[model samples]
Target: MISSTLIFQSEMFSDWIIYNDETHGEYLVTVDHSEDTCYCTCPDFQYRKQTEKFGGAKLDDNEHHCKHIRKVIQDGCS
Candidate 1:
């Protein structure tokens, strides 16, 4: 099972942290407006989502939602 907890968040709720119970992994996630972009420190985001095909752009705009990023968005940045 995977889950997330908000460790820190800016007033705008753009940046925060998420942790995994099973993997004991901590991920940093950032949500940026003007694009609703989500960045995650997890390997999935670094190696898979953030790709080299589009000159280092996210691999697939519609499919780049990493677990950490999705959790942040679902949590309403709370």
Candidate 2:
């Protein structure tokens, strides 16, 4: 299994898909263009989203994103 996160995107497409590896297993994180946001199956993402919503804490902001999402962007599409 791939230990590191894998990012896939195309120049023509605004959406991105990441193959993220977790302790339990691997999950896919999709950056949906229509929604203009990223969604992940990992619990961390869900919890953070809800916490940020209620806590009014900006955890995933412009310069910050979930580890999975950050990996995708940092890894690059090329």
Error of 2 at 34 (Å): 3.1
Off by over 4 Å in 1: 1-13, 51-62
Residue pair clashes in candidate 2? none
Encode model 1's per-residue lDDT on 8-58: one tens digit a residue.
556543667787888889878876543445677877788877644432223
Model 2, 1-78: lDDT tens per residue?
223344555443233444434444565655544334555556667665423332211323534366655665565522
Highest-scoring model, TM-score: 1
Query: Candidate 2, 39: how far from true, in Å?
Result: 0.8
Model 2 earns a TM-score of 0.49
Model 2, residue 72: distance off in Å is 0.9
